[model samples]
Target chain A: MISTTNESDPNPNESTLVEASPRRAWYRVDDFLAMGLAALIIVTATVSALLVRPPNIPQLVQDHQTSKVRLQQLDPSAESFSADRKKIIKQQAEIESSIATMPLKGWLVRPGEWKDDPRAAFVKSDKSIATPLLATFGVLLTLFAAVSFVQGQSAWRFALGFCGVFGLALFSYVLAGQEVVKHYNLEYALWAVLLGLLISNTIGTPKWLSQATRTEFYIKTGLVLLGAEVLFNKLLALGLPGVFVAWVVTPIVLVSTYLFGQYVLRIPSKSLNMVISADMSVCGVSAAVATAAACRAKKEELSLAIGLSLIFTVAMMVVQPFIVRASGMGEVIGGAWMGGTIDSTGAVAAAGELVGSVAKDVAATVKMIQNILIGVIAFAVAIYWVSFVEPRDDGSKPSVMEIWHRFPKFTLGFLLVSLILSVIQSQGIEGKSLVSSIVDGTTKSVREWMFCLAFVSIGLESNFREYRKMLASGKPVILYVCGQTLNLILSFLMAWLMFSKVFPNAASELLAK
Target chain B: MRFINTGVLKFACACAVVVAVWMLVLPVVGDFPSVRQRIEGNRAAGINPTAVFYTDHPAMADIERSIAAKVNAPTGSFWQFSARRPK
Candidate 1:
């Protein structure tokens, strides 16, 4: 009987009850504490309808497991590019066609005239004061927990990472508390300035949270949340012109900027190069996260890339309105240009508002349309990198399958969520109360988990010691400046063509003055 | 061999514990309340994008409508659906 029972026996599969490595700790005491905390959060949220969210566990699991299918067929070469492009175009055309049917008034909010539209004037009478003190409480708690637990090579790592989180969390809280969620903040530039000054003082930032452990969790959870956000119904809101504009602009921005980064600027680091390229090409912070995950970019690289994207994103947000107005572009034109040009959606919306009426709608609509390109772009890049870039190296290159295996497991989950959203949206389940609840829940889980993980990862990977040695400042900073200039120029040009020439609600004059 | 396997299992167990504490569980607990508040804040903002500034003031309605028109435009998402093409 012992001889008959070989190593090939399937009994172990049944008896062992193998759990995935990352998830296995759910049975532990620390994990139990974490869950106890999570459940308390849910209970608090459930007590308030305003904080309502649906379930996201299923969505998270699905996104990770779903990518094996996409991976199996994803060998995108120059030859395959033709068919792929056609399929993508056809698919896009179909989505746009359906979007054209929405009664134009549903998502609409008439901005300029007070007497005409019936919504709040961007702020309500019950205006509340800033909640910085509470946010400070949250930040200090995080810092104490982190600094006391995780030690680095020196004191500065402990200081900077903790301070960085405290500062960023406070800023982020304030932004979200306001009218629009400003995804990128101007304060990051100030952080860079401060860090540069103190980095030499070398207060290293390794605290309790390990960077690799956090990145692994943050990326996956982020993917699931990203999936929920990329619902099909949302895409259908961007009409024909919106579709045409996004199609024309997004890829052009990505490819051209990547080339500029490589040839003109001659950036050396592959990790930095890829991330900057993705950030330029897509929806800034989100794109950086996805691309960083796909490429297995180091935690520091992801953090730096995001920090750069945030800085530039704010620059565009602040400067774009003045430029559009100064350039003598009309409201619609200015809006389109600003919207198409800026990297972050929140910043784009803010810039558009600064211009006046027509520009606000056009800019926001255009940005929203372009934002839909995120999933398609991420998938296309992942496939292309694994299949074409890897294979081109011949014997020295990693196998495509190996590349696939090495690919982030979480993107699969992200795509699956997209597919499920697409299917449900296709079946007319969108806009319903239940679906809305689900999306709310899914997105909530994503933001809560992902942001914390990203912060923790940022803390872990970055320290005063390594950051001081690694930062070679001259060329990369210059490239960032140059790329930013190109973004402004091209975005304004597109705005001119679309708003002034095509749709021109033509507030061009009152605004231009 | 048995001792080695047990050691390996123990190490795996420890990593799993720490990872879960760091990623899934801790994050959900710490920030979920703030996140919930943000979501409601977003919806309260969403229900009337213009409402962030003025209360029931008459000027707000026009501003809200304008914001709605801009945000809710029939923009294409990813794969466009046929037959509903925007005029």
Candidate 2:
């Protein structure tokens, strides 16, 4: 059962004073503050990119459009058609590359790849990472410190604690950047949680440091920024076949898995069951975070779900490609299957690439289409939980006002940002290029750092004892394995049906692109 | 004495295990022909297998561009014009 207490402090490590304010008013204010900060960053980046866009970009797009028409007139088998196609590709790439980027492009950097020596992560071609790292640190500190001040907390204490948290996050990146670790797709989220758990369980997370462990705040803010990347236009990448595989099959798997957990496995914590189901069926950690926030799941539950996802993702990334090859599955079908089943977007691409280029494109696009479901799933879950999941103390039907009060406000910000960006992206080719530049140059890096910090905070707040109890039943693990198996079988069936039987030409069409 | 407690020892052991896995076991595994080829190929093609979103993958840009061009192109082939036109 989900906790009904409306405490502002989601983390137990937070000061008692925060927990005392168990009112709807406190949550609204806090949630809005995080959303507001995310909105400010996104709006600033978008406006800056627009202002600096090269004037010739529109003309270049026009030229690219003309080339596309010319290419369409020729026989695809002819030498002229091949040359025309290559020229158009080059033209399009030039137009995209020519767009002016956000000013924060070089200022926001993470640790780069490293081999044996750890220091190599900080140094690239004689250029030290210190400048950019410090810049990012300063920017984040100022923003978070301002939020802390607004919340009537001591900015000094929060800033001090944040330094330790930021350091841990940096170290997590360093670990994730190791060549061998990165090759295995061992993401920084795993390392972040591990380091946090180690510190909190062993040495004990200091009370002062607890001031900076605002897990929900960082995650909600990062998710709002993540909304900018969810352009709805990307849904049509593989056309209807992609939609059938990603959009149609995913929800069925998610719902069926949830039902299985609730009825068959009888997982006591419905929130945990839902998080695991959604994360396994949808995109991995990102979907888990969104669903957990929507249902107001405990931080420990979220941590456990993400841990399970990380372990299985690495295994599937390694094993699935071999299965596809051994079975002699068509590249498109195999890619779609991997994309739909693999929990992580990166792992999906990796597995798809091992099959073939056609598979890689299909897999990544299918995952992108699936990624859009995060917004819809989070919204639907919030409404469902408010209406059905939350027990009414008075035994009366919950009112609209009550539902509104309990909803996670950050989700609205996420959807709105996505909507606004999608409109911008749909304006024309230039519009698409502008939105891509803003995201790739600035907001993406900032969002990543925010997620990293959130995971570190999750680690710092989690206790091994809590995990011991959580895992004692082993039901969550069982739920995950069962849900993933269903996902794999169903995704394969949907991929084959859509790619091979329903739309036989879809694979060739995508490959021609 | 305080630094030598059971919790501290546990932490140390865990760290050691993590280091060994990342440094020793993973590298050896990565050196295998199949794994090495995939990793090197991904690196050469500028694909970060660890990317979390479509935008994070460089190859996605080209794919998106191609799709967009196709969508915006003229609707029918030149040879199909005037076929079955009403007289």
- CAPRI tier for the interface of model 2: acceptable
TM-score of 1: 0.56
Whole-model lDDT per candidate:
0.46, 0.80
DockQ of candidate 1 is: 0.03
Model 2 agreement with the true structure over B10-81: per-residue lDDT tens digits = 888988997887677776777788777877877765567677677778687775555544433343221121
Off by over 4 Å in 1: A1-184, A187-213, A388-400, A426-432, A464-473, A500-513, B1-87
- Candidate 2 lDDT: 0.80
Which stretches in model 2 have alpha-carbon errors above 4 Å?
A1-28, A124-126, A511-513, B1-4, B16-29, B66-87
lDDT of 2 by residue, A1-513 (tens): 122222333444541101211354453465787789988887777788777877777687787677666666756666575467667777768766776456777788999887666789998668998999999999999999898777766677778889999999999999998877776778888889889999989877877677788887888888888899888887877677778889998999999999999999999989999999999999998898888888878778887888899889999987998999999887888989999999988888888887877777778878989998898898899789878898889888889988787677778888998898899888877777778777887889999999899889989988888889979999999999999999999999988877666666555555563
Candidate 1 iRMS, in Å?
Answer: 18.8
Q: Highest DockQ: which candidate?
A: 2
Alpha carbon lDDT at A326, candidate 1: 88
True contacts kept of each: 0.01, 0.33
